[model samples]
Target: MSRFPILPRHQSGFAYIAAVIFLVVIAGIAVVLLRLTETQQSTVNQALLASRASLAARGGIEWVFNNPVQRCSQAPLSTSNAAPAGAVNHLTDFRAESGFLVSVSCSFRAYNEGEAIDASGNSSPVVKRIYRIDAVACNGTANTCPDTGSVPRADYVERAQVATICLLTDGAPCV
Candidate 1:
């Protein structure tokens, strides 16, 4: 007797239920997309940090080469107690500029590769000094590189670079 016809009992709230389900599915998709975007952003940020660390490490190596005091001097095996003064100062400067800690180590090896003629037309032993230089850059709370003291951070980044340099001297070792 009413103006509208009565719907079946089982299908009374069909539209409402369907709308709810659709909303839930849409929300799930949105959440997944948001998570994906966040993950991509995180990856990009990590890449940037890694690039900065690499640049810092390379800069440290260049500093070692350019600095007269640390050029061929033997680096201490452990930086816990005493690192080269020049290296430490350079690291400090870089930290201020790029918020990264850089540590540099170097070792020298000498080899005699037969003999060579000098400008004076005198033959002398060709002393080859091979310098192995290593630089480690990290964003950590530890005082030195390799960040052993601090807890693992999701945003932490580190980079290492090695450079080998050979210098030929006239029967002289690289001191």
Candidate 2:
């Protein structure tokens, strides 16, 4: 009567209700996208951690090979308390500079096991050894030998590598 026609009460709040519904839908979408992004970031971080652990394991095995003590079978590995000096089998642990722990184990076997006799068919006590080396590294804790592949915690990441190392006393001259 004064300036505009009267509107129904239900139609009065139509625009406000529509705007609220639109905002809720947008918020839901945003939350979903954020969660996806967070999940992706977590995956990437885990991958990077696993890669670091792998590098740490590789470095540990290399360190074992390059170590004169392990190569010459001179002393008990620093990580082992049960292994005797110059023992055939040994275990070692190395902590990397990047805050990771690496564990290495070597299993020794006689390369000439059944046929240790020489060309003259004379048995001689040779100083040759066959070493099978295995290494594992982790950010939190390392897996022991013969593990069942269970995750200890949500944040722990680990990697393992193995190699066949053959050390002969006659090949490399030890000083």
Best by lDDT: 1
Q: Write the per-residue lDDT of candidate 2 for residues 24-104, one digit (tens) a residue.
A: 999999999999999999999889988888888888678768853455355443322232233222233444366666767
lDDT of 1 by residue, 24-140 (tens): 999999999999999999999999999999999999889877742346454522212232333333376778899999988776665677877879999977666666778899988
Residue pairs clashing, model 2 = none
Best by TM-score: 1
Score every model by TM-score.
0.76, 0.65
Candidate 2, 171: how far from true, in Å? 3.7
